[model samples]
Target: MTTPLKILISGQHGQVSRELQQRLGDLGELVVLGRGQLDLSHPEQIRQQVRAVRPDLIINAAAHTAVDQAENEPELAFAINARAPGIFAEEAQALGVPLIHYSTDYVFDGRKDTPYVEDDEPNPLGVYGQSKLAGERAIREVQGQHLILRTSWVYASHGKNFLLTMQRLLQERPELRVVADQIGAPTWAGSIANSTRALIERWLAGRAGAWGTYHLSAQGETSWFGFAQAIGEHLLANGKPCAVLQAIPASAYPTPAPRPLNSRLDCSRLAREWGVTQPDWHSALRECLAEQG
Candidate 1:
């Protein structure tokens, strides 16, 4: 009998992590570690835990995702997002296992009018972006077999994401204003997890020829305001209370960390290389909402 792949994933409560846990259960011997089990801020702990797990595949889903908060705590963010991932890469290299890491589109400064490609030069606008970018570079420098997936505007039915936050605020507030300047795909965590599984399956089938960075997000793009409007419309259509969504420029809402105006990612490379075509953002959103019910 073929042995099930031993997969070690970092992060427990994260949207992607949770979805991965549900999706990858039957395919592998899945072991998920949360902050309680493996504190990412402590690099030594990360090294220890990964060594102990000794997985055949390492999927890093944990990250310091508090964008505004990262500005004030750059060291903590770097420790978790940058330092921890490098350690994982090193461990994966030592174990001779493939490492799967998640990154963000915030690496770009949003100055370009078009969607960002994998080869695009990163110009982070905040500490959070810098830390994530640092992690990407560190993993690459380790010369380990890795697949770094850069996604954007990730959300899910659970977790502290835009979709849940908006759902709560819409019910509480009479009217809401969302930033309209920032543009990107509102990718569902479920979609990301499923695509990841497909990639792993291909790799296990000995079809993975390249191991590098790829943009994995929902197809098409929308601004924050547009996303919120869609969410509100979806909620109202489902007989749920929704607030009046008003579109406002990013300038109107000053955040601790300057957000990229254009968070759009060009996922053509992933489609061309991996033959993975992501569903539209709207369709994915509907699935997420339906799952919530």
Candidate 2:
């Protein structure tokens, strides 16, 4: 009898991590560590945890994801985002294990008229993006067997995301203004987890592609306004009151960290290489809501 694979996942309570826990349970014995257990801001702690786990695979689901907050705390952001990933890569390499690190579409400035592919040059508009980009580069510099998965607008039924926030606020407030200019897929955490499982299964079956960065988001795109409108529609269908949503440019909602005007990522490489695809944003949102019910 073969021993089950030992999978080490960081960020136990994150949107993606929570979904991963549900999806990947049958595949292996999971060793999941959240911020409380393994504070990612400390490089030594990261190295020690990975060394202690010495698992078959390392999935880094943790990140300092507060975009505007990162502007005030660049050191903490880089410590967790940039330095921690590098440490994981180093530890994973030492243990002869593959590392899977999540990245963000914020790495790009969102200037391109079309969707961004994997090779697009990144020009981050704020500290958050710059730090995440640094993490991507850190993993690459390690030159280990790793998959840097870049996704955007991540949400889940059970986390602090736009979907849940909109669900509540839309019912409470009479009117809400959402940014309409910025665009990206509202990728559900469950979809990301399912796709990740497919990728892992392919790799385990010896059909893996090149170990590098891949864009893993939902199929289509929409702005924040469109997403809010969809959420309102869902609430109304469920016999709940929703607010009147007003479409506004990103300028109307000034944040400390500037968001990309176009956050669409082309995920063809993931499909071509690993036969992993994603549901369209609307379809995924519907599915996520159904799961919530």
Candidate 3:
């Protein structure tokens, strides 16, 4: 009989991690660790936990994702986003297992007018993006078997994300002004988890693609305003109070960390390489909301 795979995942409570727990249960024994069990800020703790678990695969889902907040605490961000991922790669390499790490589109400065491909030069505009870029480099430096999946505009039904926040505020407020200039795919966490499962299944079945970086996000693109407008439409369809959304330029909204005007990532590489693709942002959003209902 084939032994079930022992998968070790970090960030038990994160958006993607939560969905992964739900989606990957039938595949194997999932050892999902939260902050209390695996403090990513501590490199030794990460090493100890990975060594103790000795899993067949390691998924590093935890990240210091506070884009603006990271500016004030660069050390904490680097420790969690940069150093920890390298350590995970080291341990995974030691165990001779594949490592799957999530990255962000923020690595790009958003200067490009078109979608970003895998070979695109990363020019991070803030600390969070810089830290994430560092993490990617660290994993690559190990030269271990890894898949660095870079995603953009991640959200879920249960987590602290734009979807939940907008759902709450749209009902409570009469009008809301959302930035319209910044563009990206509002990728659902459930979609990311499902894609990850598919990728893992392919690898286990000996149909794995080239082990390297790939962009994993929903198809199509929209601004934050467009996403919020879509959310308002959903609320109105369900007979809930909806807010009046105003589209404003990115300059209108000054943030501690500047967001890219174009956060579009070319996920065609992932589709071509792994035979995996995601639903468009609108369809994915509908599926996610249906889950909440």
Worst 10 residues of 3 by lDDT: 1-10
Misplaced by over 4 Å in model 1 are none
- Over 4 Å off in model 2, which ranges? 1-3
Stronger candidate by lDDT (1 vs 2): 2
Question: Per-residue lDDT tens digits of candidate 1, residues 1-293?
Answer: 14598899999999999999999999869999998898999988988888888899999999999999999999999998999899999999999999999999999999999999999999999999999999999999999999999999999989899998998999899999999889999999999999999999888887774889999999998999999999898878888898888889999999899999998999998888878779999999999999998
Q: Between the candidate structures 1 and 3, which one is better when assessed by TM-score?
A: 3
Tens digit per residue, CA lDDT, model 3, 25-116? 99889999999899999999998999999999999999999999999999999999999999999999999999999999999999999999
Whose lDDT is higher: candidate 1's or candidate 3's? 3
C-alpha RMSD of each candidate structure in angstroms: 1.2, 1.1, 0.9
Candidate 3 residue-pair clash tally? 0
Candidate 2, residues 1-293, lDDT tens digits: the string is: 13478999999889999999999989879999987889998888988888888899999999999999999999999999999999999999999889999999999999999999999999999999999999999999999999999999999999799999999999999999999999999999999999999988888888998899999999999999999999999999999999999999888889999999999999999899888999999999999999999
TM-score of each: 0.98, 0.98, 0.99
* Candidate number achieving the greatest lDDT relative to the actual structure: 3
Backbone clashes (count) for model 2: 0
Score residue 129 of candidate 3 by CA lDDT: 97
Which consecutive 10 residues in model 1 have the weakest lDDT in total? 1-10
